[model samples]
Target: MRKTLLSIASLLLVAGNINATNIGYSKDEISRNNVFRLGSTEKQGQAMRLSHAKLQALKGKTIDFAEFVLGSKNVTDKKMHVFLTKQLDGTPIAEGTVEVKKALSKIKWTLDKPYTITGDEDCLYVGYTTEVATTYKVLMSDGSYDIEGCNYGYKDGAWVDTYGMNKGSALIFVNAENVGDYTDAIIAQSNFEGYYKAGDNCNFSACFVNAGTTDITSFDAIVEVGGNKTTQHFADLSIKPKEGYSFDLKDVDTSSEGEQSLSVTIANVNGAGKETDTSDNSVSANLFLYPKTMERSLLLEAFTGQDCGNCPGGHLNIEAAIKKTEKNVIEVAHHVGYKPDMFTMSEDPTYIFFYPNMSSTFAPAAMVNRNTYANVSTTPIVSATDVNSLLSTIYYADTKEPYVSLYLKTTLDESTRELNVKLYVLPHKTVPHNSSIFNVYLVQDGIEARQANGGDNYIHNRTFRGTVTGNAWGYLVKDIKAGQLLSWEKTITIPESIHSSYYADETKNNVEAVLKNMSVVAYIGEFDQNDNNKHTIYNCCEARLGESHKQTGFVKPTDVNSAEAEQSVSIFVSNGKVHAGGAYDRLQVYNLAGAQVENADLTKGVYIVKVTADGKQTTKKVLVK
Candidate 1:
């Protein structure tokens, strides 16, 4: 063990020149044949490690100084803070008190700076001045800020190159390497079918002040729906070159269900050698999700005006239906020239479209599934009976997978208080049955605005802002085969109405808000499929399935008020009585462990039960034997 320890100690001096010919320590300064132990005592023969200034002149430029020999603190596994504080004469000096233990372990500092040692063994030892003279101070803070540890620099010096004896005490290093610049390039749209069907031939135009440096040219883009075939496109040499070059993708078929995506790869040639280098330059985008319709297909298109006082009641009726069915309903709350809405499109054109050619309308007027029209002025508010009927009648496809997947990248300019939202649209594939199109809707979540009736600060759920792509009358996706990709982007300014200061400072420019609260809902389905396959109402098709279609039902709500409520809605418990009114029912109870505790049939009352839909079995709780 002594030989091995001596060998390790000898290696520390191998990297530097040590001229200690006539050096001799006093009997008290160091004991022969034992490791040095520093203790707090001004003893007669004890030698002191001089302050940095005392050894400054002797510190050779190429000889880096590690920790000076100090007396041990005697605490187990305790690391000491090695600093060049005071000289042997006890004089302090600015810019000389640097920590240097890191230099001792490896003979070189983390920044690759070396040191030169000079002077006699005891008279003086100086570390040559290098860029790393003050480098020791960085390690003093236990590495809060890059003292050569993981995530940035070299591994911790204390652990590496140590023997197995200190294995448990060894420290690991996690440093990050520097990589070149990598960017996602956006190409200009030309012959580009711009959003709003407006850009037409010139929709795909470069919006960037400059293409940064170089444009991405090569990629493989694939679109899919479920496990079925869709559109796929490959660009082996699709380089954008410098700046002005653009690629146009027009009328690509984007019809299917259940999430589509675009994947691109660049040939791996040279590496930037730094993770911070953002030079990969890949281009990607997401397509719209839902299918577009020629005419509006809202399950509930409410025709309301600003002055309507009782419209709140009608609003509640529609809201209740949405909750009951999980709202596959396209509910358009059209308020013509409405004032001070917690949520409203600035133009109010949506309201006018539903009420085309009508100058005014009564309060609380609504069209349920657009199958029938009801006026709050004459008809009593829609009771639970009316709501349930409308909800049950709505046809929706609950099982279709998402054909379109959307990803939104937002850039916030602090100086301009403007947010740039780039939307990408890629199709899963061609609609299997054809006649399918894509629809993209911009939605904002968590808007707290004051509604005159529905609570002062009402939370508007999944409010639609406006449409940017597809046809106002539903654009037909064309010419693209299954597994091909189509993409478009738009930069929109967040309106001041939704930006009202409720939680976040309205004026603060933050990219996170747009990515977090705002999303583009993309979906695709058969534009002509009606409720005959599910549940359909008056010349319109719904996206969600109806009762006739297979579904998982929730436990029915209890405590019905109206006498017309079902006296005994069918339940599937092994032994439990139905509680239409009120009373206790003693029923056979079985625990989940398959043990029977009690059995009896008494009056009807509410009881909790554990249900297993897969096995079609339910165990009821026991009230009495």
Candidate 2:
């Protein structure tokens, strides 16, 4: 298993610049909206979804005032309505109006009669409405914060979820006086060992928020896993109100096999005294321990094109970063963004959809493992100019353990030019069918291509050839269980020639296939048809033609009889009809190009026949006479 470079003791230190308020604007969001305004005549408003735990903290407490920070530019006198409602568009239970007159002004509204929170509602909406036809600006957070589904917008007479819109949240704060002097500790976020192998140490870490009015001097963190409890006491903490402290517990004994529940809770605030609120003091997560950990190879899909001048620099930076890390990283250069080149495949443009703007400016961008870096933008796409951030993200991705192991076996026919591929999937944890998909990509290296900025004889490496998986996203697999082995077999015919223009002055040219420069990349990731942000690569592996690739440290469970049963099944072609020796629930036949072929119409020289029985599958190659 891979571990982070941070020391165990250093991991317990508190994070800096903790936001005291429940939800506030971020500095990034503020800078982006230096002179922002709602330049429309239509009525518009911003609202934030307050969680039940945050609302419960103010239960029975008097809401003294509400404040809003307005932008500095084009500030004009306008009437603002502050309201607290159960729903975004529902009638407000508490309403107050305040007038704003200056720029960068903090508009405050003191309720004539203080409103006491009932604390019974699941969530509450706090926001304001104002008319800003031309010269009105409201400060908004960049919406890159961790809170999801907490920000909403009102436009066209309706409330909409603005989380995916990349629009900032309104900078609104609600104040309430606590009923009594009490110390409260809230577990704002926690990180625990998600995938562990047998005999490995389990680590737990969390960031605590001092939600209470009083300062937190010391606290006890109790971690429970697999019926075992371990408590770590921290003293002399000095965690003040609205501040945060983080702690880590390492080497805990949670290495038992199978699924386990892990929970971390803060108790004994300031040495054996109960906090005012315990609702947000605890967090829990489920983890699965496998018998062994598999090696992971990250996929870096670089979006580049020959027309992009900066793409050459992007390639240099990426190559340097990969060389520095010395990690097994598979690279696929997608010819998209600036302009489609000869190497561009049909599905290459779809990768550009991951950009927030979906613009051609996405060229010279790179995504490592298709994961969203919380510290970076919400989307996985990052500009290649930011080499430091890209390298950091790559290093961060290397620490995660793969949930499944992939094994690829390939064979190539010299005369027929057919590449037979067999993929075996061994899942260490349960994965949902809807969210996961398997993809196979064919990429070639050392292709002589013309570069706009570099040279005429510039060689492109790892250029995308075609998608062997039929579907652009991938072939969606069924629900997978722990220790279950699934297999798929397909044959892809290598094209004899490809039409592409090498130079700006030349027309389309025929490029011959280079067998030695070709390789197959297979990966599994989360899939979403509409949102590319949801597509996250879990694990990927690559194998060159005429070679076999197998993952080490994959110890299949002995109880899994399906692996043997798959071998027992026999498939052969007799009199141009496919026959199976064992009973099968379903049978299918496909030609070399992955298209399904009917049994009756099977006059092919070679075909792939798949037999499935009792939830197990076996595939074999048959020759039809």
* TM-scores of all predicted structures: 0.27, 0.71
Model 2 lDDT tens row, 1-625: 2112111111011223232222332222234344343435445567767667656655776565666665542333467778888887678878877777764545777777777778887888778776665544454544332223456666656776664344544566666554445566655435564546767765556766565656678777888877789888877766656455767764467556677788888899986645655665777877777664457789998999888898999999889888788888899998887787777777777777777677535668888888777677668888877778778868777766567778876777768687777677778777754668888888888888788788989998988777777666778876777677877766667878655433353345545679889988999877787876676676789999878677774455664345645655656565678866546898899999999988885785889889998887788788887
Most TM-score-accurate candidate: 2
Per-residue lDDT of model 1, residues 1-625, tens digit only: 0000010000011111233211111111222212221122211011113223212323443322332322222222223322121232333221233333432131211223332334333332111111221112211111111111111111222112111111110111111121112322222111211121111221222121012222333332222222333322324332331222223333333454223443222222122221111222233344323333212233354544334456566567667777777645655454443442323444334334333233543445444432222232112112222565445444222222233333333344444434433333333334444555454455665656445566655655445555435233234554544344443333344444443112245443221233345544433434442321221121122221001111111011132111113212122322343221122243344544666544345335434443334333344443422
**Stretches of candidate 1 exceeding 4 Å from the true structure:** 1-306, 327-334, 337-386, 397-429, 432-463, 468-476, 479-481, 495-625
lDDT of 1 at 192: 17
Worst 10 residues of 2 by lDDT: 5-14
lDDT of model 2 at position 100: 73
**Model 1 Cα shift for residue 158 (angstroms):** 93
How far in Å is the alpha carbon of 393 misplaced in model 1? 5.4
Question: Quick one: best lDDT, which candidate?
Answer: 2
| Alpha-carbon RMSD, candidate 1 | 26.1
Candidate 1, lDDT over the whole model: 0.31
- Model 2 lDDT on a 0 to 1 scale: 0.69
